[model samples]
Target: MLLGRDNMKFSNKIVVAVIVGLMSFSGVVVAEDINTEAIGNAIGNITSEIETAKEIQSEPLDKVRINWETIPGAVSYRLVIQNGESTSKDAEVKHFNRIPNNGYELDTANMFKAKDYYWRVCPLDYDGNVMGPYSAPKPLIGEEVNPKAPLATTEFEKMAYSPLYPVFSWIPVDGSGGYEIRVSRENKFSPGRYEVVREMTTKNNVYYEEGGYTWPGHYMWQVRSQNKVGEPNTEWSEPKYFDVEQHVRVAALGDSITHGGGVCNVPPGYAMYSWEYYSQVPIKNLGCSGDSVQVMAQRFDRDVMPFSPGMLIIMGGVNNFRAGEDGWDTIAAMEQILAECQYHNVIPVFVTATPINPGLMSKVPTIEPAAWNWKEQQQLLNQWIKNQPYHVDVTPALTDANGNLKAELTTDGLHPDHLGKKIIGETISNYLLTTFPSYNLTEK
Candidate 1:
C-alpha cells in the first residue's frame, strides 16, 4: 500500500511539472506577439507623421512657395512638378528636383506660364532615400495675362469678324474714371490713322462696335485708362492685335481636344486652341472641350457659321462613344453639320477620330472606361470618315502598332501633346496643301 501511494504521488508531481512547462511556453509566445504589435504600431505612427502635407502659397506668375514643419533628421526635401496629373516622374519640370531649399521658386524670376501643374514634396535622409511618404500631390493653376494691362479676355489675339459683330472688352481698372479705345489699320499708333471712336465710363468695359473698318483688313487696337485720382493717362495696354476679313475663314471644329485643353509641353500655360497653332490657314478654333456630337451640332450655327469658314475641319465622336450613345447618332450629327457647312459654301474637312487608350483612361478617376462596344463604334465611325472625300487620316500619324496612341504625342489618354499636335497639324496642312491649292497658305 505504501509503495502504491508513493507511485501515485510521483505521477501527480510529473503531471504538474508538464503543465507548468506548457504554460511558460505560451507566456513567452504572448510576450513576443505583444512586442511585435507595439513595434508595428510605432512604425505606422511615424510614417503618418512624416507624410503630413505642408502649407502652400502661390501667386499668379510670381512664385510657388512652400512651407513645412522641419523633420528632426531630414537633411533636405525633394520637390517635383509635372504637367497636370502626368503620373510619370520623367515629366518633372527642369531644375525642380530635390532642391535644397524647403521653399522653391520655379523659372527663376520669370513668370510661370498658364498651365495646370502638379507638385509634391518629400523628406530625404542623408543618403537621399526618400524618408517617409511624399505630400499628397497638390495642383497649381497659372493664367496667361499681362498683370499691368487692362486685361483683354477674348477676341484680342485671333481673327475677328463683323455681321456677327466682334466685341472688344477689357476688365475694369480701379481708380479709372473713364477709358479711351483707339483702333488703327497699322500697328504703329500714328495720330492720323488712329481713330478714337468711343470714350467709355468705368461702368462699361466693352466696346459694342467700333465702326468704319473694311473687310480682310489687319487692325490693331489699344486701350488707355483715365484715372479718376492720378495722372491723366496710364500706360496703354500692350496693343492687342486682330484681323477683320470678309471672305470665309477656315475654322477647326471638334471637342475640347480641338479647343487646346491639356496640350502643353514647353512652358506652363494653357494650350492655345489647336487651330491657333495651325499657321497654314486662318483657321479659328471652334472646339469646345467635353462636347459630344449632338452638343456640337446644336452650337454649330452660333459658333461656326458666324465665322463663315471656308473649310470646317471636323474631328469628333470620341465623347459620343464614351457617353454610350449610338454610333449612328454621331454619324447623323456629322452629316447634318457637314450639310449646313455645304449650304453656306463651307467645305467640310473631316479628320478621323483619334484613338483612345482605355487602359490609361481607366486609371484616371474622372474618366470612365469605355464599354465593350466602344471600340466597335469608334472603328465604324473612323471607317465612315475615311470613306469621305475630304477625310484626313490623323489616326496613322497618332496611333501605334497596338492601336494605342503614340505615347509621346498625348499628355493624357485623349488630348494631344506637342508632338501629337505637330503630327495633326502636319497631316492637315499636307492635306490642305495638296487638295486646295487656291487658298492662301502659311507654314511655321
Candidate 2:
C-alpha cells in the first residue's frame, strides 16, 4: 500500500512540472503580440500634432493654401490655419485660436514670393489609437507671381465712355487666349464662372467683350488662361475702371523697352513699371523686345491704329541703333509711326532711346560698336519730329546734360527701376498735362 502511494505521488509531481513548463512557453508568445492597452499607451506618448498645417501658401494680398500630413489611420484630415501671433508650436496659424483663417491677408515682404510646402500621413486603426501620420508627401510650391489687375490696352472706340458699358480691347495674354473672361465691376469676380469667350486655339489678338457689372457704376475685367487641365493660370491683367467721359486713353508703343525688358526680370524681357501703373490714362504697351524698324513698320497698322488712342508714346530707335536700317532709314520708320498716328488723329510723343549697356548692344553676333548712341541720322529724325505738328520731344527733361541716360534711373545698366519709371512717367505726364491740354489717356 505504501509503494502504491509513492507511485501516485511521483506521477503527480511529473504532471505539475509539465504544466509549469507549458505556462512558461505561452508567456513568451503572448509578449510578442500587440494588445489594445499597449496601443493606448503609445498614443498617450505623443506630444505634438498638426496645428497650423505642415505646408502653407499665401498670395501676398489675397489667398492662402493649407495642407498637412495624414495621421497613421486617419479616416479624414483636419487642416486648420490661424493668423495672429504664434504662441508655442507650429500652431501660430492654427484654428485653435479665435482668429479665423480667412481673416488675414499675406504680407508680401514678410513671406516667400512663392511658397512651397509638404506633409505626411497618419494611419488609424478601427480603434482611435492613431498609429502614425506616416509618410512624406510630395512637395508643392506656391506661384510667385501675383498678377495685378490688368488695365484696358485701348480707348473707348466710340469716344463716349460709359460707366454702364465701358468698351475695352487689350493685347491678348499668351497661353491665356481662348479663355473665359471674368468681369467684376465692384466685388471680386468668380474666376471659375467667367464666360468662355476665347477658346483653346486662340492666338495673339485684341479681346473685346462686354463684362458683367458688380455695382451700379463699378466695373472690372480679367481673362484667365486655359489648357488641357482646363483653367490654367489666373494672374490677372491690370484692372480698368469706367467713370466719366473725361477718361483719357494712351498707348505706349515701341520695341522691347515699351515691353519692359529690363524692368520685368522675366525671360530677359522688360518688367512693367509705374509708368503704365500710375499713369491715369489707359496705357497700351505695343512694345516687342528685339524688334526692328522694318518689323515695327510691318506691325504698325495693327499695333498703333486700332486703339483709336488720343496719344501715342513711342520709345525706340535703340534696337535700330545697329539695325541694318540706320540713320534716315531708322528715322523714316519713326516718321511712319508718327504719320500714321497723326493721320489717325493720335498725338505723337517721342522718347529719346534709353542708354544700353555694352552687352545688349552686342546682341547681334556679327556687330559691335556704340552703346545707346543714336547716330546723326537718328538726331535728324528727332530734330525733324520736334518740327512736326503733332511731334513733341520729352527727353531733355529726364536725361542728364550730355544726353546720357541718367545713371540713377536704371536697375541693370539698361532696365529702369521704380524710381526710373517715376521719373520717366512724371516727365511724360507733365508734358501731356502741359503741352496737350486735352490729353486724358492714362490712369489718373
Candidate 3:
C-alpha cells in the first residue's frame, strides 16, 4: 500500500503524488529517499513562531533584536528588526549563521525615532531554503519616544580616596554594552565634561580602577554606558568626586611584542626602565600581544585618547608585520592613532621596537626570519612617522651599529635584558634631554 508519490501517508494506503515544496524558487533538489528525520520534527516548520522575544530593552538606535528557539531544518535565521514611525526607519536585516558558538549577538544601527517596529523571521536550510513559510507580521510594538543615553549613575554619595589610586563605583544598566567613566578636577563644566573613559563589555555594573596617584586635588568622576549599536560613543552618568595629592601620571601603550614577552621575568618593563633612566617620570605598560594596527585604531579613542597624558610612547608593528599585515595600508591605522593624540593635545612619541636576536627566530615558527623580518617592519613604520609633526623617533638609541641586534648588548634574542634595558633607557633619556631639555629631572 503506497501512501503517496513522495511517500506522504494519507489514509494508510491509497496512492497519490505530494510535493514537499521549498519556499525559494531555486529549490529543486528531489531527494527520493526523503528526509525521514524532518517528518514530525519537534523543531517544527518555518512559519511556526518560536517563543516570543523577552527582555527586549530599548537602547540607543532602536537596537531591537529577538531571542528564539532554533527551528527544525534551519541552518540560520533571517532577522528583521525595524521601526516604522519616522521617515528614518531603523532596520537590521541580517542572516545569523548557526555555529557551535555559545550564543549570538547583532548590532542594530540606523534606527528611526518615535515609531512602531515590525519584525519577523525566515528559517532557512543549508542552502537558505526558507522552511516553506514566513512568520505572521510581528510588530516589535514600541513607543515612538526618542531614545536617550542611560541616566547617569554613581555607586554612593560619600566617596573614598587613596593617595596611590582611586576607584569609582557606578550602578549597573542592562542595555549598556560598556561605560564611560569621567573624572573632573573642579565642579561645573560642559554638557559632557570630565574625561570620557570607556569600560569593557560586561553583564553587571562597572567599577574603574585608578592605576596610580594624583595631585591631591578634589576630583569628581561619572559613568556613561554604551552599546556597540548606533552611537559608538557613550553618555555619562552623574558625577562623583574624591580627593588626592600629587603624583606625576605616566603610562605606556604598545603591542604584546612590547609587553616584554622576550625574556622579561621582572617588573618595570624595559620601557619603564628606559623612562627611569632617561627622565625621572614613572611609566606603566599597555601592550597586548599580536595586536594589529587596525585594532589599535579601534581602541585609540579608548586607550590613547583618554589618558590626556603629556607624552605617549607608542611601540609596535612587529605583530602587524609578522601577521603579514599589508605594509602600504598599515600606516592608515597608525595615522588614526596619531590624529587622536593630536586632537587631545597629547605628544606622540614613536619608538622603534628593540632589535630582534636571530636566535630568537627558532622559538617562534609562525614568524619567518622572525627577528630580522620584525626589525624591517619596525623601521618601515618609523620611516612613515618621520614626516609627522610632534613625532620623536627613538630608533637610533635601540638598534646596534650595523642595524643588527647587538650580540653583546642584549641578554635575550628577542627582548632587552637588564643590561640591554639599561643602555636603551640611557639612550632615550639623552634624546628627551636634547629634545625637551626643559623636563624637570627629579632624580640625581
Leading candidate by lDDT:
1
- How would you encode candidate 3's per-residue C-alpha lDDT over 253-312 as one tens digit per residue? 665444432232222221222333333444434444456777766766555434445776
Error of 3 at 356 (Å): 1.8
- What ranking emerges by lDDT with the best candidate at the front? 1, 3, 2
Query: Which portions of model 1 show Cα errors greater than 4 Å?
Result: 1-247, 263-276
**Runs of candidate 2 exceeding 4 Å displacement:** 1-248, 261-274, 322-324, 359-378, 391-394, 397-403, 438-444
Output the TM-score of candidate 2: 0.45
- Residue 387's lDDT within candidate 2 is 69
Sort by TM-score, top down from the best: 1, 2, 3
lDDT of 2 by residue, 195-301 (tens): 32223222322332332121333444555455545555555555544432222377667665555423222221112343443344446555665677667777666
lDDT of the candidates, in the order given: 0.61, 0.46, 0.48
lDDT of 1 by residue, 1-444 (tens): 455878866765565455456655877543323443454466567667666522132333443434444342344578777666665767666434444333443442353532466677787643467777777666644322224546553434433222222345565554467777666664244533544443434345555442323344566666767766534455777776666555455777787666553422111112232434644655565666677988778878766765576788898998988667778889999898888888888888999888777766665567777766776788888988998889999888778887777766654466666567767777887888888887755521
- TM per prediction: 0.50, 0.45, 0.40
lDDT of candidate 1 at residue 4, scale 0 to 100: 88
What number of clashing residue pairs does each candidate have, in the order they appear?
5, 49, 14
